[model samples]
Target: MVDRGPAPRRGRPPVSDEQRRRQRLAISRHAVRLFSEQGLAATSGEQIARASGVSERTLWRHFPHKESCVEPLLTKTIDAFRTVLHAWPPDVDLAEHLRSAYQPVLNSPSATDVEAVLAVIRLTHDEPALRAAYLVLRERAEDTLAEVLSARTGVPSDALPVRVEAAAMNAALKVATDDLIHETAESGITPDALLRHREHLADAISFVTRRAPGDGRD
Candidate 1:
C-alpha cells in the first residue's frame, strides 16, 4: 500500500468537543465510584482505569490525577446556572427567572449522571485531593459567574462590585451545593429538594445584586 500516512487514532472517529467532555465525564464517574467505594486514599489509578474500562494511559489522558475525577460533579452546576443567566429575560425578576427556567436537576438531569454527582459529593467531605480539585472547578466557575454578573448588571467584569458579587454568589452557591450534597448523602434525598432550595439561593444572589439599591437586571 502506498504511504497511507500516519494511522488515525483509535476510539470514536474525530470526537467533537461535546464528545470529549462526555468522555471526561465518564472517566470521572468511574473514578468517583471507585473513590467512594474504597475511600480516596485506597483507590488506585489502576482501579480507576479498570472501573472506566480504559487503560492506565487512557485514564491519565483524561485526568491528570484520580482526585480530579470529582471535577465534573462540582462544576456541572455552574454550567447549568450560567446557561440560565445568559438566557434570563431583561424584564423578568430574578426569582421568576430561576423558577421558570431553573431546569431542576431531577426534572432535567440524567439519572445516570446524578448518581455520579452523589458519589463525588460523598468523597468531597473526606478526600483532601478531591476537595482541592473541587476548589479548582469553582475557581473557574467564579470567572464564569463574573461574566454572567457583568452581563446582567451592565458592569465591567473587573469592577469591584461585579467581582465581589461574583465571589459572593459563587461562595453562596458552593455552600448551598455542599449542604444539599451532605443532606442527600444522609437521607437519600432527591435532587428536586435541591431545586426547591434555590429560592433561598436566588434570594442570596439577589441580595448581592440589589445591594446598591438598583435593578438586578441588565
Candidate 2:
C-alpha cells in the first residue's frame, strides 16, 4: 500500500484574517504602482500579479477587477482614521483626541501603502473607473463616520443633523487628504509637514462639527 502523506494536508494552511488582509494589501500596493506608471488601460492583471509576486488566481481572488486593486491600500488610511474615531473618549473633545491620536494613525499605514494610496488618488483624475471606486470607498467612510459621530453625540445615525455633520466632515477630510497627497507627491512631506497637515485636518473636522470651544462644549 502506498501512502501519499495524508493527501498532502488537503490544502494550504489556514491563514488568519489579518494575514489575508495584509496579502491583499501587498498585492494592491504593487498594482497601484503599475497603474500609476503605465496607466490603467495599459496595465494588465497578469502584470499586476507578476509584479506582486502572486498568482493571477490569487490576485483575482483578492479583487474583482483591476481597478479594485487600489481599494485595499486606500482603505488603510480611512481605516486608521475610523479606528481613532471609534476610540474617542467621551470626556475629551474631538480636536484634542484627534491631535493626540493622529500620529499613530499617520504611522499605522506602511510608507509604501501611503504612497500607493496617493498614487491611486492622483490617478482618479484621469481614470473614471478608478474614480468610481474611490468615490464608493469615500461614501463607505462617511457612513462609518456617521455611525461613530452618532454614538459620540447621542444622536441617531439616521438623523438629518448627524448625517449632514458626517457628510460635511467627510468632505473636509477628503479635501485635506487630496492637498496633502498632491504636495507629498511633488516634494515629499517631512515629519513636521505631515504633523501640520494632521493638525489642519483635525481643525477642519472640529469646525465642520462645531466642536471647537464656545461652539457648545461644556
Candidate 3:
C-alpha cells in the first residue's frame, strides 16, 4: 500500500458567538423554569446544568453562579427596551411611537417565551440574588438610556437633567413591565393584556420624559 500521511484530526466544530449566545439563553430558560418551580434557593447549579443537558462545568463556564443564570433572560428584556428607545423618532411623541412600535415587539415572542420572561421577573422580587442580577442589568440599561436621551435633548449624558431623566425613564419602564406581568399572570399575554401594558408604558415614559402632547419635543 502506498504510504499516506495521518488522517487529519477532527473535533467538534467551532461555536459561533451567536451559537454561544443561544446556548446561554437555552440554559437560562431551563434555569428560570427550575427556579420558578422550586424556588431559587432550592435550585442548584447542577440541577440547572442537568436540565439544560449541559455539564456543571459548561454551566459555570457560561454563568458565574446560580443567580447569574437568569442574567441572559433579564438582559434580553432590558436590551429590547433599549432597542425601542433607540428607535424613538424625535419628531414623534414618545407615547405615540411606543404605541406603534412596542406592541409588535412584545407580540413577536412566543407565548411560552413571554411567560418565561414574566416568571423570571417575578422571581426577582423574592430572590435577592436574582434581584441583584436584575438591578445590575437595569443600571446598565440606564446608561444606555442616558446616551439616547442626551442625544435627543442635546445634553451631556452625565448632566443632572439627563441622568435624572434616564433614571426616571428606566424606573417607569421597569414598573410598567412589573405591573403588567403581575396583572397578566393568569391571562397570559393577550391583545387586551398587551394593550394595557403598552398604554401604561407609553403614558409613564412620555410623562417622565415630558414629551407628552403639545410638548413639541415629542
Candidate 1 on 161-191: residue-level lDDT in tens? 8788778877767666666666666655565
- Give the Cα-based TM-score of candidate 1 against the true structure: 0.82
* Candidate 3 Cα deviation (angstroms), residue 128: 1.3
Comparing candidate 1 with candidate 3, which one achieves the higher TM-score? 3
Off by over 4 Å in 1: 1-13, 104-108, 211-218
Candidate 3 residue lDDT tens string, 128-169:
888888888889989998888777667789998778888988
**Model 2 per-residue lDDT tens digits across residues 105-181:** 33454455566677788899999999999999999988998888777767788888778877987887787787777
Pick the winner on TM-score between candidates 1 and 2: 2
Using Cα atoms with residue i matched to residue i, what is each candidate's TM-score against the true structure?
0.82, 0.87, 0.87
Q: lDDT: which candidate is best?
A: 3
lDDT of 1 at 132: 79
Clashing pairs in 1: none
Sorted by TM-score (best first), the order is 2, 3, 1
As for lDDT, the candidate ahead, 2 or 3, is 3
The lDDT of each candidate is: 0.71, 0.80, 0.81
| Span of 10 residues, lowest total lDDT, candidate 2 | 103-112
